[model samples]
Target chain A: MKPAAFKYIAAESLAQALALKAEYGDEAKWLAGGQSLVPAMNLRVAQPAVLIDLNPIEGMAGLTVKEKPTSEPHALVIKAMTRYRTLERSAEIATHCPLLHETMPHVAHPQIRNRGTLGGNLAHADPASELPAVMMVLNAKFKAQSVRGERWIAARDFFYTLFTTALAADELLTEIAIPLQPDTPTARTRTCFMEIARRRGDYAMMGVAASVTLDANGVCTDAQLGYLNAGDTPILATQAAQSLVGQSISAAQIQAAAAIARDEVQPPGNVHATVAFQRHLATVLTKRTLTTILDFRF
Target chain B: MLCKDFSLRFEMTDVTQKRCFVLFVIKMSQTTCPPKLLQIQNLKSKIPMSDLHTITATVNGKSYTRTIESRMLLSDFIRHELGLTGTHVGCEYGVCGACTILYDNHPTRSCLTLAVQANGHRLETVEGLAVSPTQLHPLQQAFHEAHGLQCGYCTPGILMTMKAFLAENPHPSEAEVREALSGNLCRCTGYQHIVDAVLNVKDEG
Candidate 1:
């Protein structure tokens, strides 16, 4: 199928791109990797009058990891246009954010990852996408810019609903900043991401990302549990996370957290999975992710 | 001529002043301009039209320049424009990877990409996998020896995808081979022969 005829403009600079977006407003769409947008256009589900191509813009495709200084927290900054292939192979990401490195391969297949952009995936805001859950668990922040100015939104607040984000019509997601795990011998942080997809590259019926920080006495100090395909937005198990924060990571604690998460999530029934099945998967994945992070058997 | 001078003045004013001047011109032109010119201006103001784009890309080791509609699919450009039919189009959606090709040395779905987006880029289709007219690439030869094809439709795409995969990972395990081929789906031969063919080629080295 062929797409509807549309005007294309290769954006030369960030300012020009922002101006074009401001001029065209809702009639224009920003072209990132185009893995999702192009296909949607071909299917005639999405037709925009103007496409501002962001591929040619400079300073929008790299990764930078800043280690913690005297009083500052460690941070991992990823430019919006950075490809998934780059993130999958980036040593900087592996060193700074190991959880993302482990979760990268689970994102579609290698071919799709080669062309898919980090910003595109986030902005697409698919309920089943892996990056949103990962970002939610890691407490990442997104920098959105327009001709007016720039502002940062937390990962929890950035994702508003299904296929929608806090981004305005004229705003572009410029960067993703994830705070890295602190280097503390007394309290060690462990993270894990897991999902169950029917096929290798297919979207997961359910996925979970869990991060836990344990103090010296083997008691949990901090915990974050995020689920994909759990609801309209990436669902965060705040009540479940609080339940595990003061207790040691044990089978009973994991089960309690998993049960709370399974009860809190309300996934819609799709052709591939029913609501009950998705809820069951949420429980299973939560347990698996927490166990993997805790390195405890069953 | 009077309208032309008025538009020149409209263009030279500041933004706030220009907005008022443009509204004034439109109101004045509605009464003075001919019906046909007024109709044309009305159509232009209400609707946006697509324009042809000139794109230059190196496909199969040869550079070509073509003017295409902005919405033309790259898979169609490879087949209809450049006359390379090896890259097959299956589902037209990103799900089916039969239209896969090497875009700048990375296996990308040609069906999902716009032809204009491939401008100033390098692409390798199924036609480029052969070393010569009579000679076949090692993977192609292995497919032949191992009976990797029954319908021969998805072979070109699988070959291109695997070529990029093997270049990155010269020695991949059987599990890794299956993982790499997860994107490309082959209905014929049950994929056992295909896996065997790749294993045969890996064993050759």
Candidate 2:
């Protein structure tokens, strides 16, 4: 019931942490909050020689609203280092971006939320995680930095496979930018997130995030849906989104999109839910999520 | 792998047929750790710290510093180091809630947390219950009144979890308590008495 011995250092700053990472290469890990890293270390699944604790690193946590590159309503720029608790506590996010708020509470217990960081969660890159799915739906931009330089990676291309991201070994996730969509008279935008898990605080068996935007004529202008625990990476339901665009919100159209999403995902079998059941749940949840999004009286 | 051999004397044929029930209750007290740290004099050795890393933390209302190995977990610090053995270590990977403790009013798994992580944090263990050494906290009293414990290995963890849960939502309904305790598993008492204990806390207040 004890972990194997390892050295630990509470890094003074991000630069120091990155320097340590660069010195140790893959043998060193940056420990933030320890919600995920601690569990992995205790399980002996991940054994690093030294851990550069990031808790002491200043100015690395917070939620900030930034200006997007384009005037497009869907383009929102949200900072990445935001804590889940900060987002969960934000009334603005709840009112403006209810999909993000809805999915935040399902990440883990409140205690874990107090310590878990959005950057760590995204960088950990569990396909079943809510943030990854939400990021995909938002088409968020990730800014990764190292001792050398920085680069932006799109959410779609960021997550390559299970527990894998485009991030290099030494790089740190600095920020995430999400597009902003204002609920105005001109643009009737709707969003909903739904998931089915065996127990609370457990990973989702199947989850869906849907963002539906409609024109004045009630024709779907754009649709972006993200599926979690349904594939190797957080996948965008392109077929589902395509099936809904330019079409009126109809049960038939929703069904077609659900079918497309269900057929598209290659869900792996796990103890929480089977592949077939997960596929079925994906269809059911996608339809339900869309229905909730469309049912908004705004 | 190194070779090892040992002999165990038992009439398996006779014992097996008599009772399958007794098998599960057998408690093994053998220590998994080595008895003493032996120095390999002939080997090239970079002398490590003579004393293990010392961690200072406030437990309950008392503060103490204990020397612990780098591998020592918070649960081990609370249990073996400080002799507050109430905190049970189970499913060391942090999935099981048997090692849950209140670290500065936040519930955390001690098994998954390092002792060094608690340096400046306030940790309240199951031993923190009761004002003095003799009295029982409301939750602990309720457990006894409701017969909440059978094989009490999980009792301390259950008490710690219930205490925190009640602090947040004092008058939680039966279903709410059930949802809150979903992370902590108890193999004995069918969880009926544990539920009863938490329900008693709600009624008492």
Candidate 3:
């Protein structure tokens, strides 16, 4: 397959990229990493008239820990072009956002991660992608910039629908800011990620990312679980997660939550997994993830 | 060795009078005859300047600057433009991982990227994996010894991918090697000997 003839321009600065986006409007596609977009282009599924290459923008492919004055949670600000391989290798990701670190291996193959950007994946909003679910579980905020200005979109509200985002056509996702879980013992956070695919590295039939913030007495203060391939978008199990809050999350409660999660998810059947089988996987993975998080020595 | 002083000069004259482009690849110090210049015929004559991009990139330690169509994938550029055909293209959509190459020290799917994107980037293909004309890199040697490939079509991409994998992992367990190889699809060897081939290499780290 071959991509159609298009005008390609590499933007050297963020301002230049925004200007190009403003100038070209919806006919232009912002090229970051091109891991997913280029493949769609090659398949003739997406035929943009202009591709604004964002790889060359200065200071656009790194991460920094932005600390607050102890009252507010610190943030891990990852530039838009930061590669997934970098996030996987970074000690900061493991420390600051364990859910993302654990889910990195399941995102794609190492080769794809070597070039795929977190911003690109999040912006692409693939319902089956691991990053969007993990980002949702992490409660990360996405920074969208345009020639007009910049605005922050919460991770939970970012994904609008299938392969779509809340982002406007002229807006480019510049960075992703994940608030670091405060290490205060009064509310310690632990996360677990798991997915079941027909084959390793393929999109999962079902996947779950669970984050639990336990109080000093081991009571669940906050339980956030995000599921991929469960619906039209990355689905957050609000009811299932709410069942664990303000309780010890006993084995029975875990089972109940799993059942609720299974019932709540609306999975599309594929050749690999039937609708019933996908619901079963949701039950199994939900229970397994909850149990794993509870079992971890906090 | 013979192209130590190689230079390519594009004659930009007569674009209005004649729309064709004549590229003169001058093989320097190869006798002062007129036949020494290899002419690349009609390089995108009718294409507008906006649709064609002149990009310079280094591959296998050799630099090439060519005006290519914007839609040309990096895999096509390496094969058709530079003639480094060692990197195979099994699936153009980056699924098969047969078009893998090292872009700026990271192994990437060349088919998923445009040649215009390779501007100012360093690329290493399967052809660059040898120490000399008579010598193979240790991984290639291990693959040869272990019979890692059967059809050999997917070997180039696998070699390039594994080269980067081994570099990063240094010493990986059998399971780790298999996990790293999950990105690449190989039908012939069932991945046993491919894993064996990877395990055979000794990482200095």
Candidate 4:
């Protein structure tokens, strides 16, 4: 369980970290929280020759909520190294992005969350992880910086397949920006996060992040169901979501959408769950999540 | 996780076929991996043995500086480097909470953390809990009274984790206490007595 030998450099600034990434390229890895990376290193699954520690970089870890102008949607900026514990207790998140606030506790245990970062979890793009699904449903954007320049990758375009992402070798995920519901009384948005795990802190067998916006007449204007462990990447049930739009969130609509969601996924089976069971979970979670959203009297 | 798709439905009737399957597993773990990985490892990179990093941190309120390999785990630094063996190691991966310690007053898994990452940070291990052998910490005394431990192996970690847990929530309900203990795993005891021990601590102090 010992990690392979490597040169560690605690980058003092963002510029230094980017320069180090450019220098080492594929041979180096930017260490954020080290909750996932170190475990892989200990298993000898990931063996990068150089580890550029980004913790020491100033202004790299924080959370901020920006209330936009009257017509613009509000935004939440979370720096890459901002730990999960911080997000768990953030009042701003609870008020703005309720789905993310609810999903925080399901990421991992308190011990792992104390060291795990939001950016690290998203960039990892694990099929079984919860944050990626949350990010996808919330319409978040990731900022990737390198020696060349910085670029913004949309949440939909960020994750490619499996553990792979659109991130380049020399790029470092700087921060994540999630759009929040507009601060208007008429803008009705409800979100729910739920997962079924054998143990409390174990990796979930199936998880869902569901969000819905209703018009003044209680008709669904938009809907999204982001699922983890359901496909090669974070599966955004587009067809399922489209079925909900323009219809009242009744038992029929919810069941129809859930069925579509169950069929849209290509869930891989494991010892804990079979392909049939995972599909069943997807259907049940989707219906329950949408049912919960319907109960919210907006 | 990368090898989740590797099907084991092949017939293993011969040794040659079994050997080929083992080699394929190794290849999936190391060497050329699937296209899912961001880093394409075609060239085998050398592990730099001589590159040592200096870490200056306060462990259990005592200042210490050590130059060691950057890949050295924080749990090993506490046990081997600082000679604080009270911190136990179960699963080196972050799943088991046996290597839990307080990093900057937050209960953190030292196994998943690198020693070099602890530079200029504050770490509290299990050895720092008691003042002496005769006078155990109040929580430890409560455990001794309530029979919280059986094998006594996962005690240090559970105590360290609860030390921070109780600090955050001084008066927690039984369900809340169980939720806080979700990270720490105990094999021998069914956690009924361990939960009793933690609840007993709140009554005394």
Candidate 5:
């Protein structure tokens, strides 16, 4: 199928891209990897009068790791246009955010990853997408820029609804900043990402991401559990995460937390899975992820 | 299909213009006409042109420049315009990887990529995989010996995808080959032969 006719503009710089976006307003759509946008356009689900291609904008595709002092937290900064393939293969990402590294292969097929951008995936904000849950678990910050100015939105606040975001029409998602887990020899941090899809590369029926910091005594000091396809947006299981903190990871505690997560999530039924089945999957995935991260079998 | 529809619409517009011209001539000879008639003529003349983009890319080691509609897919450009039909398009959507090609050495789905977006880039289609019209690449030879294809429709894309995958992983295991080929679907053969073919090549080395 052919896409509807639209004016195409290749932006040479970020300033020019922003200016073009401001000029075209809502009628213009930004083209990152075009993995999702082009398909939607072809299906006539999305029709923009103009397309602002961001591939030509220099210095917009890369990953940078910032190691701060012991008092300050380290961060992994990724440009908006950095492709998923880069993140999957980057040793820097593996060292800084191993959870993301482990989760990269589950995003889609390698062909899609070759062209799919990190910002595009986040901006698309599909409820079933893996990156959103990973970002939520990692406490990533998104930087949105407009001709007016720039502002930072937490990953939790950035995703508003299915295929919708807190991003303004003219604002471009410029960068993603993920705070790296604290490196402490005495206290170890472990993260795990897991999902179940009908097919290997298909969208997840339900996904879970968990990050836990355990002290020398094996007591949990910090925990974050995020679920994809749990609701309209990536959901943070706050009650479950809180239950894990101040306690050593145990099979009973994991089961209790997972039960709470299952009760807390309100997911809708789809052709792939029923609402009850999704809730059950959420509990199972939560238990599996927590146990996997703790390196314990239950 | 959209191209056919566009041409049909253009022919219908031509017929309508001819009929309008005849009516306008008749009215001019009979009496003064309303301003609406002249406005219609002006509007007909002002029919906007379709949005077009000029792209320059190196396809199969040769540089070419072409002006195409902004929405023209790279698969169509390679198959219809460039006359390189080796890259088969199974599903126009990204789901089917039959249109896989090497975009700047990375396996990409040509159907999902716009020709305009490929401007100033390098592309290697299925046509470029062989050394010549007669000689086959090592992967193709392996496929031939292993009978990796049945209908042969999905072979081009599979070869392209595997070529890139094998370049990254010279000696991939059976499970790795299956994982690498997860994107491309083949209906004719259950894919055991294809996996065997890739493994055969690895074994040959």
Candidate 6:
């Protein structure tokens, strides 16, 4: 079916988009990349009277990395509007964060990535999506701006509920800053991402992201674990993380963490899977992610 | 009570032409024919509409543009607007690859994109899959020789998808071909013949 007629305006700058959004309130929607919005409009789920297309806005799309002082670790800063295609092509993503590079190719397809922005995907915040879960595990921060002012929202706090974010209506996500995982001399951090879907390239029914930091003594100093489609938002299994921290990545420790993760998640039963099956998958995927990371073959 | 009777009014302006019109419609289905509806409908009929939204892009080697409604999908835009009806539309919700087209030099679901979105973008449809009007492209020829298509509804999109798949990976294995065309669905052919067709086309000079 065709969408209802609506007015379209291409915003030239960030200020214009904010002004239009503030003026129209819920009647308007900011069109960034249009990967999610266009489909929603076609399905009649969203029919904004006015669409403030932000593709032409200047200075909103770019990618760059900043190295900290010679003593400290570097910061690989990815702009919010940067397309996934850019991330896939960037030598920086491959060099600094090879795990992120490996995960980017599995996001939809090349055509969708050519237009889908990082900010748009995060903002959409589908529970079954991999990007939001990855962002949470990576501790990325979102920089948002509105006509009134600008603020930084941590990934942990940015996601409030299903499809809900801390972003104000007038605010536009302008940047995503990922602190480069430090490279220690003695012990290296291992990370991995995996998802199970009914069909390849489709949204995941259950997925996991894991980061494990080992000390010189081969003991886990820190662990970060995240699961998608397991709750209202991407939930971090703190219990699972705690179970692995300060312990060696032994079979028993990994099993204990996976068991805790399975008990911690309360995934909804959608068309893809049953609640019991998803909980089981959470355990299996958690074990798989941890094993992949510890083996340094992720 | 009054909440059920509430209606919202919005003004829509044509992007190409700076013409504006007000539209008011009641959301709830207790319709007694709102007077505002008639006024908007009458105003819409009065304007001398231009088919300016008709897009111009090169399909294969030829360039053409025709007037299209703002709501006309890119899939329909290629099939009807350009009079090259080789492209098919199935499961218009972007899942079925029957509407796949080479958009901006990549395989994209035309059904998922608006015609206006392709305003200045280069596009290639199934009509582009030919050496000449009388000759078939390698993929098309392979499909025929392999008996890859039965109903042929999904053949155009499969061919276009394979063409893009081969451009980047000229020597992909059988599994790679399956991974690339997973988005396209075919009911008649169990996709074995289609997979063989892609493999055979890769061997063409």
Against the true structure, whose TM-score is highest? 4
lDDT of 6 by residue, A250-280 (tens): 9888999999999998786654478899999
Q: How good is model 2 by TM-score? A: 0.83
Report, for every candidate in turn, its global Cα lDDT versus the true structure.
0.83, 0.74, 0.84, 0.83, 0.83, 0.75
Predicted candidate 1 versus true structure: per-residue lDDT over A52-75, tens digit per residue: 999989899998987667567789
What docking class should model 4 receive?
acceptable
DockQ of 3: 0.20
Candidate 3 ranges beyond 4 A from true positions: B1-50, B203-205
Task: Give lDDT tens digits, candidate 3, residues B127-176.
Answer: 89999989999999999999999999889988988888888788999999
Give the Cα error of residue B165 in candidate 6, in Å.
Answer: 1.9
Model 2 Cα lDDT, one tens digit per residue, B81-160: 89998899876755567888888876777876778778877999988888777788888899999999998988887788
User: Worst 10-residue stretch by lDDT in candidate 1 chain B?
Assistant: B4-13
Candidate 1 TM-score to native: 0.90
lDDT of candidate 5 over A56-118, digit per residue (tens): 889999989987887778899999999999999999988879899999999888899999999
Span of 10 residues, lowest total lDDT, candidate 2 chain B: B1-10
Better of 2 and 4 by DockQ: 4
Residues A252-291 of candidate 4 have per-residue lDDT tens digits of 9899999999999888766568889989999999999999
Question: Whose lDDT is higher: candidate 2's or candidate 5's?
Answer: 5
lDDT of 2: 0.74
Per-model TM against the reference: 0.90, 0.83, 0.89, 0.92, 0.89, 0.85
Error of 6 at A282 (Å): 0.4
DockQ of 1: 0.20
* Fnat of every candidate, listed in order: 0.45, 0.24, 0.47, 0.51, 0.39, 0.12
What does DockQ give for each predicted structure? 0.20, 0.15, 0.20, 0.36, 0.19, 0.14
Local accuracy of candidate 3 as per-residue lDDT tens digits, A1-298: 8987677889989999899988867567889989888877786656667789988888889998898988899999999899999999999888877888889999888889998999999888878889898889989999999988999999998886666688887899999999998668799898899999766877788999999989999999999889998886899999999999999879999999999999889886665578899899999999999999899747
In model 6, state the lDDT of residue B132: 90
For residue A158, give model 6's deviation from the true position in Å. Answer: 1.2
What is candidate 3's CA lDDT for residue A164? Answer: 66
